[model samples]
Target: MGQRVLFIGLNYAPEHTGIAPYTSGMAQSLAAAGWDVGVVTGLPHYPQWQVHAGYERGHQNRDIINGVPVERVPHPVPGNAGLARRLGMEIMFGLRAARARWNNPDAVVVVSPALFASVIVRLRAKYHGIPVLAWVQDIYTAGLTETGSAGGFATRAMRAVEGRFLRSCEGMVVIHDRFAQYVQRVLGVDPARVHTVRNWTHIGPSTHMDPATLRERFGWPMEDIIVLHTGNMGAKQDLGNVAAAAARADQSGAPVRFVLVGGGRQRPLLEELAAHAPRFEVLPSVDDETYSALLGAADVLLVNERPGLTEMCVPSKLTSYFTAGRPVLAAVEAQSPSAFEVASADAGMRVPPGDPRALLAGALTLHGQWVESGGTRHSGGARYVREVLSRDAATKAFIAALNAVRTKGHAPTRTTTIATLNN
Candidate 1:
């Protein structure tokens, strides 16, 4: 029989954004490669933060998606829950995940973001003599501290708990080298146990569309320079800076319009902040076709981060932006992973985070280039996507890492066994 593996994560298929895509992609690829794969995941309720259509909030069910069986558990869909409520939800999901049917398997892969869930699942699997490999999407402790979401005492406690969870795993996979360094230095994990696998663009191909026609379709201004930012508008994004820049653009008559598309805990706050800025608009998230159309229609794609949010995550939006073959302008720390991706790909320019003036200036500069060059400046981002972010390469690397973990076997667990003797 082929090797069997189970994936435990809070997010999975049907949610195309954030950690869901990577987790779903990895599971499907493994199933396609002849490994017996099953997933224990929550009902789809990611960037939208609400249960998807046809899915109930508290129902537990089982089904197959793309040839892989999944055990879907229900958890609270918090739109803007406080830190305490959010942690409560995570713990609830973790407890339910531990109760999910466990297929006898060679190994298990635990996806983080639901950091507490990883620990819960790992301990459960270890009890059954199964080795687990952690797929760290974002550092939980770093996120809490960097976003100022938790106090110093709380952050330090989380760090210790999270570190212990990761150390107990057989191996770990991170999306970037910077994350691996943080794991080794701050979390005190063995360097050899960590692996790096860059995330691939999960969006469909973007085609060239007439800017005027798309602008009309999306109800955007025809004459204004469009600087678009898509995906989650959470605390880490610090989109308030973008609103401030748009207000400045309006005052200076820069002919620039800043649009944010997507939903998150911060959307209402962003809407209120951008209320007075004429050039700033917030739109609801759209379907894939409209999303692609919007990307093709924009003069520049943008990424904005909070001032000190240096290492929590590498925005998944960059992969899509690069695939759209448009130039990017990032308002992030100079040494962040987002800045590195932009600079290394020669795809766009970066300005200091939280500086509204710098962001506006950078957008204007990209706009000038677009106008002078007739939008023909196809940046190196697309090429980087092809050469470095290929889905096939990523999947193969993940499978190899999984196999390595499986081969090591789980540490011996002391379990009582009853024996019968016949006279």
Candidate 2:
């Protein structure tokens, strides 16, 4: 616990979904595993896209959560974020978050959402003669292009910015194997310095949640088969397919009910789709215990990604889905890293991304299997995740990367500005 581990991110706990949970989990797990952890992040505002009460343009503050120290910097809450709006918010966070000086850490891990914050981390770590690890959750340049935000020249410029800071970092961690490849091959980073650290489920254990109580609360009949998707309803999630699937399932007189629980700009679109579907329901985000309970009570957990998002990220919700002990139905790109991960886990089925028919068929297949087995699909998800993809495994890998970079030595100190961020 002697060495200090600093995590810099725009997202953190109380945000509930997306990279926030993982960032919080990583810092807490690292602390539990005998590292003194610290985090510098912005005020919590996500999923709902509004700042949580009590922290409106709040000044920078410090507190400890689960034995790890956290310093939060205040910034404007960017609701229903567009690329330009998000960029402005992240820039504000990067400047303010970097202003807080703590005792020199042995290493710093920078999380993306504010990807350019890596520059702040790299320069700060260099000043202290420590290593910097870029914990990449998304490839922003490709994300922009895939999401139709930027074009040829803008994409090239963004890529150059990404490449510069990534190459400058002492080490890097990507959440999926494909990400590692992109970092090394596309970003031109040293493959030897890039490591794959898969994200783990964020939902707590289902023990405290009584399935009967939860089902009763939701007013779902025992005969109803629940198919649920839980997480941020962001644009990258091709969730329109889910609503369309729900409508198809309802028309066919299936007893299955589709439930979507979370927040984001796309939520309204999903809600509108749900409205005409006889059995479709959309619930706002719930408390941690209730969320876990919902996961457990669900007969099938769904992972639906919009087309082209495969190049951006692997949905982190799959981890929680696997841990829920329910069979998963991942409607993602056939060759996506998510599809590959689910294939390896043996807990789910993958259909092509953005296909309503495929998503409906997969859900029906899982439902039929469950009914035939007397409601016992006997998921392999829990076991697979426990042995192969636990957060503890990620903690170990992160520590190993830190050690590797520390042993390799740090770059000489120098201020790196965004002007020089483009390689």
Superposed on all Cα atoms, model 2 deviates from the true structure by an RMSD in Å of: 3.9
- TM-score, candidate number 1: 0.94
TM-score of each: 0.94, 0.92
Clashing residue pairs, backbone N/CA/C < 3 A, model 1: none
Per-residue accuracy of model 2 over 125-188 as CA lDDT, tens digit each: 6655667888899888868877777778888988999998899888888988898888888889
Off by over 4 Å in 1: 208-210, 371-378, 411-423
- Relative to the true structure, how large is the alpha-carbon lDDT of every model? 0.86, 0.80
Report the lDDT tens digits of candidate 1 across residue range 9-83.
989988877888888988888888889999999978877788888888757978898999999988886767668
lDDT of 1 at 236: 89
